[model samples]
Target: MDALWEGFQEAVRLIVRGDAGLREVAWRTIVVSGSATLLAMAAGVPTGYGLARGRFPGRTLVLSAVNTGMGMPPVVVGLIVWLFLVRSGPLGDLELIYTKRAMVVAQFLIAVPLVIGFTAAAVQALPAELPDLLAALGAGRLRTLWLLAREAQLGILAAVMAGFGGVISEVGASMTVGGNIQGDTRVLTTAIVTETSRGENANAMALGIVLLVMAFAVNLLLTAVQQRRRR
Candidate 1:
C-alpha cells in the first residue's frame, strides 16, 4: 500500500511537470481513441437503429454475431488485424500496416458493437406505443426512428461513453496495428506496457495515471450528460 501510494504521487508529479514522453503518449491516445469513437458513432448509430427496426430473415443471426463480437478478445482482434495488414496480405497493398490508420480501424471495430448493441437496447426499451404514436402522427419509418433515438438519447450517449472507455484503454490491438512506435503510433496504454517492461516504472506509472484520469473524466461526463437529459 505504501509503495502504491508513493508510485501514485510520483506519477502525479510527472504528469504535473508535463513530462514530454508522457504528454506525447497522452496526445496519441486521445487522437486515436477519439477518431475511432467518432467514426463508430457515425457508422454505428444508424446501423444499430436499422437493426432495431428493420426486419430480415437473418436479423437474429446478425444481432447474435454482434453480441459475440462484443466479447472478442483484444489479442484475437490484434492478431486478425496484424495478419490482414502484413506484407503479402490482401490489404497490404494499401500500405496501412503499422500506421495510425490501422490502429483507428482496430479500435473502430472494437467500439462499433458496443455502440450498436447498446443503441439497440435503448431503442427496444422504448414504449411499445412509440411506433403506434408515430404512425398515428403519420411519421415515416425514418422519422419514427429519429424520434425513438431522441427519446433514448441518454442511452445512446452511454453507449458512446462505454465504447470510448474500451478503446482508450485497449493496448493489444493498438500496439499490434500501430507498432507502438515512438513519435508515431505510441499511445498511453501501449506506452505504459512498454515503459513497464523496459523497467521505466516512473514513466509507466505516469502513463497509467493519465489513462485512469481519462477514463474517469469520460465516465463522469457521460453521467452528467445523461442526468441532464433525464431532467
Candidate 2:
C-alpha cells in the first residue's frame, strides 16, 4: 500500500512538472489511436449499415470474416502490416514501415473488424419493423439507412467506443510498426514497457496509471454519450 501511494505521488509530481518524456508519449499515443479510431469508424459504420440492411450474395461470408477478424491476435496484425510495409514487400515502395503512419495503419486494421462486427450486430438487433416502416414511407435507400442509424445510434456509439478501447491499449502492433523509437513513435504503452524493462519502475507505474485513467475517462465519456442518445 505504501508503494502504491508513493507511486501515485510520483505520478502526480511528474504530471505537475510537465514531464517532457511522459507528455510526448501521451501525445503520440493519442494521435495514433485517435487517427486509427476515426479511420475505422469511417469505413466500418457504412459497411456495418450496409450489412444490416442488404441481403446480397456473400453477405454472410463477409460478416463471418469480419467476426473472425475481431478475434485475430495483435501480434499477427503487427506482422502482417510489417510484411506489407517492409522493403521488398508489395507495398514496400511506400516505405511506411517503422513509423507513426505504419502504427496508425496497423491499429486501423485492428479496429475495423471490431467496429464493423459490433455495429452490424447492433443494427440488426433493432426491431425489423423500423426498416420496414422507413420503406413504407417511401424513403430512399440512403435516407432509410440514415434513419436506421439514428434509431440505432446508441449501439453505433458503443461500437466506436469498443474499437477505440481496443486500439488505445494495444502495444504489439504499435511497437512493431512504429519501432517504439524515443522522441518519435513511442507511446504510453510502449514507453511503459521500455521503462519497465530498464527498471524504471516509477516511470512505468506512472504511465500505467495514466493509461488506465485515460481509458476510464474515455469509456465514461462514451457511456455518457450513449445515455444522452437513449434519452
Candidate with the greatest TM-score versus the true structure: 2
Please write out the lDDT profile of model 2 over residues 134-159, one tens digit for every residue.
88999988898888888888889988
The lowest-lDDT stretch of 10 consecutive residues in candidate 1 is 1-10
Q: What is the C-alpha RMSD of each candidate to the true structure, in Å?
A: 1.5, 1.4
TM-score between model 2 and native:
0.95
What does candidate 1's lDDT look like per residue over 69-136, in tens digits? Answer: 77777777888988998888889998998999999999999999989988887887888788899989
Mind sharing the TM-score for model 1?
0.94
The reply for model 1, stretches above 4 Å from the true place, is 140-142
Note the residue pairs that clash in candidate 2: none
lDDT of each: 0.86, 0.89
